[model samples]
Target: MNILFVHGNYPAQFVHLAKALAADGHRVVFLTGRKDPEVWPLTGVEVRRFELHREVSSEIHPYLIPMEQAVLQGQAVLRVLDVLAQEGFQPRLTFAHGGNGLSLFIRHLFPETRLIAYMEWWFRDETSHWCFPSYEFDQRLRTTMRNSIILQELEQCDVAVTPTSWQQQQFPKHYKDKIKVIFDGVDTSFFCPTPVKGELILNGLKCVQPLHIGENSLLLTYATRGMETLRGFPEFMRMLPPLLEALPNLEVVIAGDDRCVYSQAPDRADGSWKQALLEELGNRLDLGRVHFTGSLMYGEYQQMLNRSDLHVYFTRSYVTSWGLFQAAACGASLMVNRDPATNYVLKGDQAYWVDLDDPQHLVDCATKVLKSAPERRKNIKQSYLKSEWALGNCIASWVELINAQLKV
Candidate 1:
């Protein structure tokens, strides 16, 4: 079967699925706005880059900018689809992400093509970032308005896919039947635990290295695509000083970019959350022990997760991060929040949970994990192995779902 995949960030959640289809001798083509060839390079798939020409009008209201940008993206994708259709490249099915409005006008171009919309997250007035402590009323109002695009795209899709049941339940009851629960999957083989050889590598160099596993050194890791409050970045930073002071052997490695990819997070005069934490914590923090390794390559990230003594992950009731699953796959001990979003993946017995409202709780959890024996970390990993989110298992599920979708 011929398949067309559309995503602003192509091959993101669809990487395993796309490659699996290509391996099965199916012709797979991806239409994406992503320009980073390094990131989107798939050996068997044909990739086409689409450009957005319409810039946000200065005269337009601030609240309308998001909707306008999405509409422009939809327009750009529509143009690419038209070209593909003219070239006799009509796909039997098109998989798109509803979050970015990519599939908004796809049906108009090819009414017969079945479309499966990927519902990553739904932006609602209340459940979204509005629930965050620092969210503003104006931002909430704008977000509520911005949700129309997703609603429209969801309405148009033949079916929808969500990585988690928690995320699928976020949609309205009317749309629940169409939203299938599927995990993006974790590569357990690549992320397996490594014997601590008493060293850490960063960009091919070891600056903040640990010599011994438990006696002379400690390895704690936290990672996200971005450093933001939704993932508990600020709160994590607040918890760090106490942990650093309590455990002198501690070495914290934070992997993420400075920008907030999800929503606007609180920033300092210099506009960096990291710098703000540095200023607030001041001499209280052992800066020398902290290593901020901004976004890493996939191999590097897996290696870091494998070496981590404890992987700390905290998130709101919103979308759960892929990092959590990766850490679990790596057989690393987890320190996660007790929020319902995380409970779906990390059971209470599988991970150490702390009350997100209290920064002290986070510190306590970290200390507890650090003090625990190194052998105990395997429990969390064992629990994750039972999950169907393992790489091959997830790809098999996707293939089954796609086959069913293609059935006449």
Candidate 2:
């Protein structure tokens, strides 16, 4: 089988599947954006980086920024596919992340090939619009227009794949039949709660005094790619003072960068959202016990999940985060937000759900979860192990789907 995976970032959602196919003797090649060659050294897989021929104009409408960027990047990918075709290369199947328009026009290039756009989210005129609570008429109009790019790509691709049912439900009813709900499975073996026997160190910290996690201390972990409003970082920070005040031995480890990934909340005139929180909660929080590991290595992150007494994950009624699944896989007692229709993972005593609007309730819920015995939280971990989202299972399902598409 000749398989080609396309994503601007190398091996993002396709990592496990690509590696598995290559190991199974399938010819696997990746078309990625300009990334460091040394970073991706996957054996049995060929990696090729494509360069954008042009850039999105600065004077273009602000609403069309993402669409414009995707067009440029998509053109670059098409050029690479053209070169490969000239060299007698034809992929039986191609998988791409729909956010970028990489697979938007692939059908025109290789009519015989099967292209599956891995649709994460389709930002349409809905309740989950980015400019919520502070919605502006102009912003809403802009968002409505942003769907053009996604709609065009959705039509161009042979099929679509979404990681969650909530995400798949976001698509229009007409396209629902063609969309498949397949999660990017978690590697339970690497993420399991095998207690670490040694001390762990975080990035941007001196090694002279490495932090000894999972020691005789009550640990609470909150992790995300960016500490932005979409993930409810601001409210979580505000609730932390009361939580820290309640538990004297509690140690909080926050893992992420100080950048805004979502939301149009104006940054503080002086610094970031994190800095603003630090200023507002000065002396109120136990500074010694609160550690911020800017970004962590995979090993460090796994240890944080496995070692924590309780892991807190909060998100709006939007796309779900992979961190929640990873936390569950690591056997951590989960404290998550109740987003009603969006959060389907908190059923059957798997996680403690808190109200999205109440900071006091969050503090009370987390504090109680921290005090609860580890034996009571075994259900959360056991539920995850028995699920269908394990890495091997997802890869097999993905291969089967691709093979089925090729047959047609």
Candidate 3:
């Protein structure tokens, strides 16, 4: 089967799937706007890059900012499609990452091609309005217009894939029937618990605590794109002051780069609530205890997760982060907010549930995990292993799902 993968970045979610398909003797071609073309090179896969304009308005108006982004992305897609036609490369099936305007253009260019869109989010919920809250006053009007574009793309696709059931359920009733759930798998090899080398310098303190087989550590980790609002960074920061008072030795390490993740709009600049909370905690919380490692390479990220005793995974709405799965794969006891999406992946006694809006609850749950017995910690680790959230298993499942959809 000839497959063409379309995404702003080359091999983003399709890395493992692309390799598996190529290994199975299928031809694959990737169309991406990634600056580093050398990053993707599979034996049976060819990659092409298209220059994309990614500028956005720094204005206070939320609607204008996103509108600017959409326009730039749409223009980029049009250019890529023209190049593909001239090159005479027509793929039998096209896989696209939904939400990007590229998928809609693919449908327009190849009207007969069977396109399967990876539907990460539908932006249909009321909470979706909160994602761009600066436009809240005109949310109803904006949502209707934005969703119309998404629905049009959905109509063009032959099928769609959703990572989690929570995300799939968010689609319109008519489109839900065509959506299939296939989770983004973990790489268990890199994420599992390993021997610690030296004291990792967090904030300023040198934490050298060891996990004796089943014992938990005084460390807590939150990894994601560092947007203060979207990933609940502000709420996590607010809960930290009280949490530090309760557990002084407790260290919080936030991973990911701020520039790439956080919006730079003038309105969003004031979203530095995390820095403020850290300042208030001051030396009382151990200035060295709150560490931000910026963005880490994949290897370093997994190593940090391996060192964590407890991982705090919080999000405002339904979207799930890959960090949550990687932490679980590493056997880190997780404290997640009560959300339907996270509930599906972590169940029973494996995860502690907290209300995202309640800072006190987050503090209490962190304390519980820190004080839990080694035996209890061991049980949680076993639960993660038993659920087959391991990387190898996840990769295998992904291969099966994509292959099943192939027209072979």
Model 1: lDDT to the true structure: 0.79
Q: Rank the candidates by TM-score, best first.
A: 1, 2, 3
| Per-residue lDDT over 1-408 for candidate 1, one digit per residue giving the tens place of the 0 to 100 score | 779999988678889888888888989998888888466578789999889987878998988887888889899999988898899988898999787778888889888888999997777655676345465888778777777888888889888899988898788888888899888988777766655454656662233443223434678888988777778888889988888888878888888887777656564565577777788889988877777777777887887777777888988878888888888777677888888788888656777878888877778778988977455644444435446888888888887888798785
| Model 3: per-residue Cα lDDT over 1-408, one tens digit each | 677888888778878777777787877888888888685566777887766665776763664455556557767876877787788867777888777566766766776677888877776546664466474557756665566556756877888888777888888888777887776666666667664455643321222443122123467778876645667776777666666677756777777655324322224455454555556656655555566666666766676666667778877665778888777777677888876657877766777888988777777777777766334534434326434545466667766655666644
lDDT of 2 by residue, 175-210 (tens): 998898888999988988766544445553322355
Q: At residue 39, what lDDT does model 3 achieve?
A: 59
> Which stretches of candidate 1 lie above 4 Å from their native place?
130-137, 204-215, 267-269, 374-385
Candidate 1 at residue 126, lDDT?
58
Assess the local accuracy of residue 360 in candidate 3 as a C-alpha lDDT between 0 and 100. 72
Task: Quote each prediction's TM-score.
Answer: 0.92, 0.91, 0.82
Candidate no. 2 TM-score: 0.91
lDDT of 3: 0.68
**lDDT comparing candidate 2 with the true structure:** 0.78
**What's the CA error at residue 155 for candidate 3, in Å?**
1.1
Deviation from truth (RMSD, Å), model 2? 2.6
RMSD of each: 2.8, 2.6, 4.7
